[model samples]
Target chain A: MPAVHAEGLFKVFGRRPADAVRRLQDGASVADVRESGATPAVIDAGFSVEPGEIFVVMGLSGSGKSTLLRMLNGLLETTAGTVRVGDAELTALDAPALRRLRQERMSMVFQHFALFPHRSVLDNAAYALEVRGVDRATRRAKAREALALVGLDQWADQKPGQLSGGMKQRVGLARALAADTDLLLMDEAFSALDPLIRREMQDQLLELQASLGKTIVFITHDLNEAMRLGDRIAIMRDGRIVQIGTPDQILETPADDYVRQFLADVDRGRVFTAGHVMVPAPALVAPTAAPAQVLQTMRDTRAGSVLVGDGDGRVVGVATEDVVRTAVAAGASSLAGLPLLPAVDVRATTPLNDLLAAAAQDEVPVTVVDDDGRLAGVVPRGAVLAALGGVPRPAAQPPVALAEAEAVPPADETALITSGGIRG
Target chain B: MAESSDDSGLLPRIPVGEWVDTAFDWVTENFEPVLDAISTASGAGVDGLTDALLLPPAILLAALLALLGGVLRSVRFGIASLVGLLLLISMEMWEPAMQTLALILVATVIAVAIGIPVGIAAAKSSRVSAVVRPVLDFMQTMPALVYLIPAVTFFGIGVVSGVVMTIIFALPPGVRLTELGIRQVDGELVEAGHAFGSPPGKILRGVQLPLALPTIMAGVNQVIMLALSMAVIAGFVGAGGLGGLVVTSLSRLDLGLGVEAGLAVVILAIYLDRLTSAFGQQRRGFPSFLSRGGTVTTTAAASSRSVDAPVTGATDQNARPEPAR
Candidate 1:
């Protein structure tokens, strides 16, 4: 079951909130709700977050993303809807029960790093546990461990005022982690940091998330951050979720003009990973296959080369037509005895921007590997160029030929590939 | 008679003063027992404190205060306290100074105990804040001497009445600032406290109170200053202290006695003001001898833990490889 689920959530603020929600339920516009002396902050919002997924909610200010998040934790009551975290119905829970659930099962990291200025860093980080009435010695030990995860154990004794903004934010993150809750709600957790610090914090969070496997609902206004961290992102506008999809899915087909406009400024090269563009490996030959058989597979597939894999499907190397012919002339019994060309391999998640240099140097298509270095797919030079082009190619269009794509002048190629457009 | 015959005034005179007098009389007649109980308890408490402060040798007490100044603030502040106290001693104002100190301390403690909770209530509820705002304004803006009338009626003429007047006069700022300080705390911090599943009381004590401490201390400083000023006015009703000397010197036009008493008040004010304000600043000034030892141990412990971090981080990463999701 999904760890957090919200169905048809409606949050209205000001006079006669229930009336406003009814008007909205009856298909009144947001403007109509506002005209009736109530502001509909979140209208008919619904989504579910799977356990261990980083579900990002991306929107500008006033989009009601923060309000939506507060409802999920029972911090703000919904005018109408249901929120379930695990087996507990958050909306149905009494105040004390909700607070208990918050204390024991969920925690939040705030944008401003809401650390107590008077308390030492360790005390601030341990505050959640403290409120839960955990004994002093044990809470402090847990807080110390959490701080160490953020590389800030040394600063635990210092006041929050003494730490820089990044370190203060780290303390806030540590505080949430110390609770050891299965779900984390981050409200622009890194938005207040400098650009360089923001990137570093993102990397640290991802690194920690890898082992923790905690379900995270991360909210941010930055599209690039959403794309980089989220497994699936929900794009919100005017208090409504317009679309929810993976990064490439959203890039390939935006739901509306607003979504398309939001995507206009996104760096596609950095957003699209090798896995998004890679095709199935054109031809495969087992390492123990004879040279004659390897050449036959390459010829049958109408490819320049074939990937040699061991029985376990781990990519061994590439055997080109030239190498296979030489090996056949030498009367090699098996291609494993022949010297194979070293294959340029990258993880499936390697961004297309990082693969450009590799794509340029290797004649054969770059190999995509999953965990255990097993062959997953191949990213040809043409595929990378096509994915980075100005207009997304139609799915039915065949993959562009490398020769035809390279025919464009180098300057035009750079313009087409980069977010910048082709020069007049 | 001719001016009265014209009879073209704005309106008849309002009997506000008469109404107030009648109200005081009614309260005095109806709550005599309760008022007497309060008077006796407070009078005993103030007297006990005064006797305790006077029990120590003047020189020993002066040294102790000076040492406290050094430890809580800086070495320079300590010497200043010592010099100021010695001057007061040489001027033969030590007894009265200690008495005034007793009064100020008791009044301040009572005011803070009442003020902070009310302030917190006002901060939490808009309705409470609305009701409190105007009442605080009236208390603060009224002439300080006016409180003495009701105080005198309730407690009779003595130090108890003086303490009561001082409390009424000094109480407004404490309440106002406490409310302001808690209200001024960052909204996000309060939300974080709530988000972490803390009950309201825990949030108030652990988050709101600690964050508002500096501001509340400022309020306490205001209270003490106001109490000292009002205590002098209380001298008119026969309360003893440096204020009594000033009143006596004023009646007799004795310049020497007046200067000595006024200067003693100044010295006390300067000492208390510096100490309380320093406490508010929290480790910004010269390091205190009392706190330095604590700092050294914490620093050592922190550094050792910091050193242990990278080693564990390295091993932890090696142990838990990134899972491909």
Candidate 2:
């Protein structure tokens, strides 16, 4: 079951919420509904978070991503629909029950860190447990453990006012970790930090997630952060979700003009991967094949080169037509002992920018291999250039080179080939 | 036609005086137990504190005052308190001054105990604030002399009446400052408390109250000052203290005695004001004892310099005029 399921959720901020919701259901614009005496902050939003997945809600300010997140935690009441966390329906729970659910199953980290100024760092971290009526010794021990997890144990006894901003945010993270809830809600938790610190925090959070695997609902206005951290990102605009997809899917096939414009400035080479842009190998020749057969296969396919695979279908090397011609002129019967040209082999998961140099240096397409070293597909130079240029490739003729690929000035090829790839 | 013209021309008189008299009469008749209970409690408190102050030897009381002043304010204030109290003793008014001090202390305690909860209620609800605002305005603006009549009618002329009148006159600042303090607590901090799942009461006690304490202490200082001023006025209702001494000296046309008693009150007021203000400042970690040169002598010198700087020009001008003459 999904860890959190929000269906048809609505949050209208002003008076006459029911009327606003009804008008929204009847397809009235948010501005029109607001004109009739209510402001719709979140309109008919619905999404389900799979267990142990990081689901990100991405939008500009006032697009209701935070409002939608607050509704999932029952911090804000939903006007029109239901939210289920695990087996319990949040909207149906009483105040105490809802508080108990929050205390037991969910924790949130805020953008401002929200450390109580009067409390010591240890006390701030232990607050959620204290609210749950846990004993002092146990809660303090747990809080110390959590502080240690965030690498802040030495500063436990100091007041929050004494800590730097990054340390304070770590204390906030420690507070949530000490609660040890199944679901974590982080609302722009790193947005207030400096850029260098924010990057460090992102790496720390990814490491924590790898080990903890807690289902997290992260809210961010930064699309780059969403792309880097989210397993699935839901893009919101004007109080409605416009698209939800993996980063590669969203980059390759945007849902609408809004998404298209949204992604226009994105560095597609870094986001797109070898698997996303690779074409299936034209033909595969076994090592035992005759040189004539290999040459004929290369001609039948595209006349550039053919991949030579072992009997188990793992790629051994590439056989170029020149090498085949050389072998046939020397009266070689079988191509098994004939030399093959060097080919650049990369994992299918390797990002496209990482293959730019190898693709530029070799005329043969870069080989994409799976875990077992079997040939999965080939990323042609034209496909890489097309993907980087943000041009859509035709479905049937995946290996066809774009005319723009040949138009590239020779002076810029080396610069383009060695451009910095995306940072993990 | 003439009668109608007269009625139209004459402005109708409001029976505000009669209404007020009747309201007081009704309260006096029905709430006698409440008044009696307050009188009895205040009488015991004043009598106990008065005995505690007066029964101590003159030297002991002076030393105690000096110690308190040194601890709360500066050592200069402490030495000044020692000299002031010795002067009061020499004038044979120490007992009356201590009685006055007792009256002010009891009144301040009662005022704060009642004021803070009302202020918290007002901070929590706009309706309560609306109701409280005008009532506080009325309490503050009414003549201090006007309260004596009601006090005399309710608890009759004594220390009880004096303390009651002082509480009434001093209560408004306590309420207003407490409400303002709570209202001014950072809204984001309050929201943080709420998001942590704390109930309203716990949030008020743990978060709001601690943050609001410095402002509330300011209110307490105001209450003490106002109560001291009113206690002197309560002398008209036969509440005997330094004010009664001044009143007697005035009746006898003895300017020397009146001047001495009045000077004693001024000394007490300055001492209390400095002490309370110092207490408020300490809440924010001021006057750090850990800092270098934070000894008693340095603090005393600093404080005296601040107080004496303004008088230097006047003294210099006076000296020049005398030399010219």
Candidate 3:
């Protein structure tokens, strides 16, 4: 049996009694929601969740992604159509049976981290177990174990408010873990965090999923988030599943215009890697090569930048045509003194947001490096944007609005780094 | 010796002697004056109290809140609420009713002003909440009568003491709910706020407050009802108006008068509750402004304890969210 199955679900809400009923009764596709009293929120939507797959329901607000997620646990009953969790038909189950199913078989981590504020982190995490009538000591021990799994072992006595955004989410995950459920539902769990924090959480989730192997249904509207986290994503539109497929398959092929448009604005720069960038590392570099030689080498190699190595086979300098003229004209004394952006190689472990921030704003392409400072390859700014869902490279040097997003410039950075300031 | 100290620490030891001593001191300081104020107000006619003299203001307030409620929900609900107020007046219950309304309004205002900030504090600081939690629990469970003694002692009867006790009784919902609202606020919005480099205060004021307004307003609504409930109790001390009237009628066993006054109180309660709820529902600043649907199933899921029960229990489908049917 499928883990979660919704067969032709229908939920309508509106005013104007007769008309609203007519829409639902007549099966008018795409009922004019604005009209009459009853607005059908979800209509004839159907889907099935297979075991052990990280199934993602992706949709913007009002598409009923959250409603769909809630229906799985019987937090909400479908207006029309049958819902089944595992082999048990949810529509047929009584409230107590549903609660038992939710408590024993599945756990939900709300988007808001709905950990009880009155309880300590341990108690909050262990609440599901406590509700299940587990002994306090055993429940607490389980909570501690779960908290450790989420890397929040030390914050046991603290409340949800005391923890950071990512930490609170960890507690939410810990609560689900303590429930000892086979299935976990995450409703935009990390969407409420800072971008950097969000990235870390995604990586953490991926790592956790790999370890726990819990059958998870993750809901998110952010296409990039969906692409990164989902084993298979179900793109939802107007309370219906448009398509379901893996990231690579979805990226190369979208189901419809809605999916395509969403994919268009995605930031792919961080997702792409040096494997896509490397041509072949050059064995030699001429010390006295003219600008023409460097230009020829770059073109022949199809490299965004060329590394200038010494006799010891260590990279001493690098040259990119975009800014090489300044370096060349400045002479070795001044040039070598100023470290070039292309020469500094970043590791694979580097997050995209950080990599973008560290990379120079100019036409410099960032180089990728392995553990030993050996050049792996390079990732251009364009590639980061591509990997991130091909979001338009904003006109601003920084991908974000610096004044608003990077506003207040962390007291330390504000003191030292002074560059091209956005003139108001 | 250490074991004895530890053993002593584990005892449920409240001093009846000390309680009696304080209680005696409190009664002498308050009981007489509260009695005096009541006799004085009754002799001076009900108009001498806050309501009759403040009739225009009371009606004006009702009108304004009712109008706002109308815009939020429907004109009919607003009009019906106004009529509810009119019934209180037609029963010749105007002065006492108004006094009761005034005390409730004042108490609720103070409760909101103080409660919301403390609630926000609780939401932000678990340590602070841990400290405040037991205090709030005590405030909640200590009984309205128990709180009245302190309220009378501190504020010394009449409107002041009445308002004080009302605040004590009603303050919890405001704070607890503010904390709840803040807690329940969508994480996405908070993150979006943070992503904008918004400080904690800004995120709270701009994002969390607006989104949580529905729940916070629900708290405010609870606070209002609690304040009203405290009104009759407030009468036992020095609070003037309908509560005083009830005490008078109940004392004489004036069946006609007692039932009439009681009915007036219910009318006032209905008017206020409806008006406040409608206003809460109609909040335009609320992100969705979708009056909580009249759905049986709220965000709350039923526990495994019951299944045959209609998922949406018939305790009138959570009045907080129910749209006008």
DockQ of each: 0.63, 0.36, 0.02
lDDT per residue as tens, model 2, B196-260? 66677888998888878767776787778777778788788877888788778889999998898
lDDT of 3 by residue, B1-325 (tens): 9999998999878899698768877776667777566435433443344544474655676677566655555566567767766666567787787788777777788789999999999999899899888888777767678877766655566666776777787787788878877887766445423322234575576567876776777678677877787877788886878888888887799988888778877776766665565455444342222333223212221211132022113212222222222
By summed lDDT, the worst window of 10 consecutive residues in model 3 chain B runs over B299-308
What Cα-based lDDT does every candidate model obtain? 0.82, 0.79, 0.66
Per-residue lDDT of candidate 2, residues A118-173 (tens digit): 88999999988988889999999999999999999999999999999999999999
Considering every candidate listed, which one attains the maximal DockQ?
Answer: 1
Give per-model TM-scores: 0.84, 0.82, 0.44
lDDT of 3 at A362: 51
| Candidate order (TM-score) | 1, 2, 3
lDDT of 3 by residue, A63-130 (tens): 98988877777666666788887888878997567667766788877787766554589987877776
Worst 10 residues of 2 chain B by lDDT: B316-325
- Candidates 2 and 3, the one with greater TM-score: 2
Off by over 4 Å in 1: A284-340, A369-376, A397-424, B1-13, B282-286, B289-325
Give me the candidate number with maximum lDDT: 1
Q: Give the alpha carbon lDDT tens digit for every residue of B139-189 in model 1.
A: 766776787788888888999899888887778778777877788889999
